[model samples]
Target: MNRLSAAFIAILSLSSVAIAQSQPVNELSRAVVQVTAPDGSGSGVLFERDGELMILTNRHVAEGYTKFVIGVLEDLHQPVVPTFTAILHSFSPELDAALLRVTMYMDGREVNLRELRCRRNASDFCIPEIRFASDVRTVSRGNEIAILGYPDIGDDELIYSAGHIASILYEEFGGESVPMWFRTNATISSGNSGGLAFNPATGEMLGMPTSISSDAETSTSLGRILSVEAVWRALEPDRVMTTWEEFLPPNDGLDPAMDPHYGGTELAAGFEPDLFEVEVLAGGSNRIHTLPMECTGYVASAPDFRLDWSGETTQLHLFFEAFDNSDDATMIVQGPGETWYCNDDGSGTRNGLDPAITLDNPAVGTYFIWVGSFGEGDFIDGTLRFSEVSRNDF
Candidate 1:
């Protein structure tokens, strides 16, 4: 039998015991998988979005591993014989959560899961809809929760635990207080890090069980679940990308090595005027690259100007000046070391609504610059300025 069929048969054999013991385990445990990481073993919860199967686990469980093994089971105490290989897609340390995508079922054939499907009256291999609670924070203290995961004691088998919410915790981010994690009286162990904590009444997942706190004297432990809000926040493309490599690739269709939209300018430190300016029409058809901060604007696919800088400088100031003072201008600079700098409204430092960015201790290298308007499809006429002094000086 194929790996998927073998897994399905194993699940079916345990359904009888699951129905007698816990109804939630019979239905929801199919989505929980045992994840084997470099450090050790933990659990992961499977979720389907837009026809793709994704797994959610703790960062400590799956982080740093490009690939790992996961075993899917539908009942507690059922051994995970057929395993699948999963790829670590992304991780957010702030949220302490990691996302994985399944690639293939681990057999000698290396069969792809995406290509396999259930046929009418012919196969038991079928993917089911794993539902998560939309209103995650609705359950407060005293609400009963059901958890399914692979604890070390269970070996390769999934384990089910029952508990109640003990308390909710909050953290501040981006000037807002958000739900961070919740403590529960769930019996979770070292191998349960990335499993599901669900509402038994609704059969919907509430959050992920990430860590457990123990009291040696009392011989008791409290489980800490990373809130569902934190999970969604971590999954966001913008918030999860901390490194420069995670930034969005340039889509302007123009190569940085090519000639700029406007001619290139060579500037050296301690130049005669200490100021260089170029007049050009701004805005382009391409949307601005996804930046680390609140950068909203549009620019041409090709850079408007290229700056070849020489020597050391304390600060290099780049700003845009629209002919119409009311026009909202913006700027993008691809500096040395592939670092990106973008500015909108200049943080209100400029005289008007123009955008400005000051690079501190600017390095001597080539800088590809783009000047654009805050609004899309806007071709505002503006003067791009480069100076050693700040915009306040001009």
Candidate 2:
């Protein structure tokens, strides 16, 4: 061969090797696990959360169950078998996602799920972590991607599908529009829900393959991916630092000192007669759609009820009590430091669909509250209650 031709071939060989080294596909695949619940089975991605190993999957896959069987892929030829049991850690019904905390192994050996590394065996070979693309805004249409999961069709083996971004969809939240989910030509099947939608070149997760859209007449199907933005917002509260500004409603120019629409009350940290309440109309012109799968409702610009708190050594509880079952209200509190807290539907037995928010060691400042309606622009009558103890205590 001529010298120039040989040099050209040598450069091409080196470039191919570099490309292969940049993308560690095998390591990324190892993080995928098969999740088996009483109702059905689906895919889950392993990630570290609060010093424990957790599996993230679609909420539908974990329906009506708190405990689940988790299995890790060992090889392609062997079927994935149940290796351990995981407990439901937390769930977001709006986001359609659930987290499972890994418990003890079948062999009785303690495992560290909090560690970044998830091992296939006792060997050093492991998937440290499945890296998620930091900013999904950078992703554009036509970007090539891959989906990894334990699809039912694959019989418990990890399946990989390749495709490209088809389109991006936006949804309105808190009066602003933001990208929510995107359509992809990638093939997402029955068991693909909650699996990783990844960028094969960089080995970064782009989104979660959650559902598939199909046309009856045309017989055409497109995969729908839950964008990382929604996923991040859904998981943000658990993190110490938060990007709440992105999800909270925009300012409507209402001052805190403005007269509360529902009137107001004052309470000290250790005040006697612990519970206080005010009658108010919930909901207004403003809509809070940005908080995906969490708080959703329409609130007014001004505070419905204002609380003059004298600071608290213990946690403070602010909740709404609907007079009847027909009303569903939401609560938004702008407290000291301008921090915002929101909640929809109280967990207490009697609270039902009423909203509640707990402020840990509430600061000594004025709190502006908005008791909102779950429906747009609907006025709801409810009682805004404040207590030092939980609503259940009452």
- Per-residue error for 228 in candidate 2, Å, reads 1.8
TM-score of 1: 0.53
Global CA lDDT computed for model 1: 0.76
lDDT of 2 by residue, 252-294 (tens): 3335666888777778888778888788878887655443334
Q: lDDT of all the models against the reference?
A: 0.76, 0.75
lDDT of 1 by residue, 229-328 (tens): 7788777887674332343354334357767888998999887687888998988766553454535567777788999999888988888888888888
Estimate TM-scores for all models: 0.53, 0.54
TM-score quality measure for candidate 2: 0.54
41 in model 2: Cα distance from truth in Å? 0.6
Badly placed stretches (over 4 Å) of model 1 are 1-21, 74-77, 108-126, 242-394
Q: Which candidate should be chosen as best, given lDDT against the real structure?
A: 1
